[model samples]
Target: MKLAELAKELEISTESFIKFIQDFDLELSECIATNFDVKKDFEKFAKENKSFLKKYDADLGQNKSVEDIAKNIQQPKDKVAEILEKDKIKVYDNGFYKSSISSYGIHQKLGGNYQFVYDYFGKKTNLSERDFIGYRDLFFFISKTLDPFLHLAPLTDWGIHKPAGIILYGPPGSGKIFWANKIAEIVDYQFKQIKKYYFGTSFVDGRRANFNDFLVEMMKEDKVLLFMEEFDVIMSERSEEKSVSSCDEETKEIVLHYVSQFEKEDLLMIGSANSLVDIDDEILAPGRFDVTIPIFPPNAHERAEMILHYLKENLSKDAILMKILETNNAHHLPFWKEISSKMKVFSNTMIIDFTQSLKKKIRDIYLKNSSLKITINEKLLESAFREAAAKLTGEYLNQVAQFLQDVSINNYDDFPKRIEALKVELDSYKMVEKPIKTIGFTHNGDQES
Candidate 1:
């Protein structure tokens, strides 16, 4: 019910309702003034409660008072006071409040600052380090390149000194963003991530004045790292036609300007692109991006390490199976997450059993989908399932069958019925079956049917 309606039903004005809440020692002044409906208030209350429960590891039923909550949740009294003021959930000196007000406020403030900075500077912090591979060589390179930056000493002319810009070029799934973040963190500089679209816009506008303003602000700060991901769209060469105006030209010019400025001001700039050759010659020339780091696809050794990392953190046991399934050139993180989610349903100790079970599941899926009577081992089954799942399409019943074949079932016969039901569900989308080739029996001398 709406607060106003509830207030009217109780035969009191909103202000009076708020006062009544205060009497109960649960502050409602702000909530009443804001006129936020009861639904929103309840949601906020529930979220705060959950956060409090998680943080304190306390049982909600045991505590009902704010003082009890503050003590249990291990938050400062002032922090609790602020939450009471904002939520208008009457906090009697004894009422329960779950989330720390100061922490929540600080988090929100930081998020807002990030958003404002991103809007103005066209940069964000992409600090997900889950994709770095071949740690030995990469680490060696990082240690070497970042040594001077870390020590706050001028590098020799051979070293990367006052680098205007550096390019991280490689195939997708290469750890460009991860490396960029590590560099920023090591240097104790603010890392800003800029999206591809922002660069495209900057290119067309001839000048990203607003973005430049943000960059200038960062310049005033002690140290900053501006990371532009998918840099090809902006830094790529413009068309030869003088009359033609493309966003690419404007982007290159703006980037060039920034690179030159950074060189003069001793700022660090990094750009990442999948296609290195697409980069504009003007920007790639001597002063702009002098150091070009090619982030090659992970070789066998790196792949092995990445597989082990995923298994250690995400897998229960089945490391062998995880390694087998970690093929296909797509990004590794999503695949790892999917496998991790799948493994969660089974017992951690039973990973070997689960691996065998998954193999059977994949075989069943393949048989149900494909016309070929192929004999698939556990490893093969796992690979097939991974591939099908990776590239599964709505139109392909076989792909759906391949994915669902391994799922747990209480009734085996009902599985087919469940599949039929899925077909019916998919009928609304006008999905068509992909044609499959008929497999003919191969014979040397003996005839086979």
Candidate 2:
């Protein structure tokens, strides 16, 4: 059964059920397949926790104002407003808070007794684990995409087969390659990179090589996830108006010929592309490279966690840098939130760049003043921040904007909050002021509201 179907049976909204899962910190993989199929465990849990689910649905479904939240938590309205303001939670013009703003998180922040929620649900688990930072939504979405491989229901019941090809599309430095490998792990396939030399006609070792022959050998192997980079350029739209390279043209033809045999042969091909705008329609049709997952830059919260992960995880516990971070509460998420807020739309590479720059500066300062305790302050952070943000040039901004456009068309419903967050970040770079636009997918086409 689908998650929506389960929610309907339980007499609650699908949105509320999803929120409940998130608030209670349930493992998405344990609850539902990427295709929204209700896992047996989650279905059982929901039915058994009937009373708790109703209360959760009632509380979270309501559009809450400061007074409403204050009353529920037995706090003064003024105090609630102050706490929300300090935490940078937005209050909508209508006086109610945005639905995305978690009242449960706020309740805990303001010292409300949220023990009942936790006691019933057991201890909550964080969505972002050590191996993966954020992108819980993306993880769930991709899980569904891998359903044909992960479960037999999709194939046996729905006649859906494993995709032969998938394209991971996003701006530069968004970690498309990382996701390609992750897909391989989830499907339990051997991850192999298809080097550029194997594309068309090239020499392998000491002999002539052809991509078709290479693909044939790969098909002979047991369960392989073949990753190809520069996919957009290699499989660009074939048009008479523009000149197409012989190699690229031939590569496209060979892939089209072999893609059908991939699923039966237990071969999965993943393409990494920076943009999807130029890719040919045939490459995106069903039974081809139709599955496209957008790899977004880390959000504000993710940025903070990522920075802290890079800094503390890399340094020794008793290291001077660790001590410096400790002094300023840099070990905590709150301390990094302020700095991360300034780094909207920064890719993972840029976050690493910030950490690298910050580390070097800390090292330099400690060297010059060996006897003195080096303080990590705004002055030092600002310098490193500026250096890291240098890559946020106009060209990068344009690429992000294009990514937003493409994702809205393809996966809007799957990631509304991310879309809005990225749009706000992208708009920050605009020279002229414009209201943040709500872009949604419609049956007709993309409509702005």
> Of the candidates shown, which would achieve the greatest TM-score relative to the real structure?
2
* lDDT over C-alpha atoms for residue 324 of model 1: 38
Compared with the true structure, the alpha-carbon lDDT of candidate 1 equals 0.46
Off by over 4 Å in 1: 1-133, 152-160, 196-209, 241-245, 263-266, 314-449
Global fold similarity of model 2 (TM-score): 0.76
User: Which RMSD does model 1 reach against the true structure?
Assistant: 24.3
Measured against the true structure, the TM-scores of the candidates, in listed sequence, are 0.41, 0.76
Tell me the lDDT of model 2 at 167. Answer: 94
Candidate 2, 66-183: lDDT as tens digits: 8888877777889888877764555668989866555655666677665554443353233233447767768767876787897687899999989999999999998988888888
User: Which ranges in model 2 have alpha carbons more than 4 Å from their true place?
Assistant: 1-19, 25-114, 117-129, 433-449
| lDDT by residue (tens digit), candidate 1, 88-187 | 4433365544322223232332232323212222321111223343343344344445545643445554454566787875544446787788777656
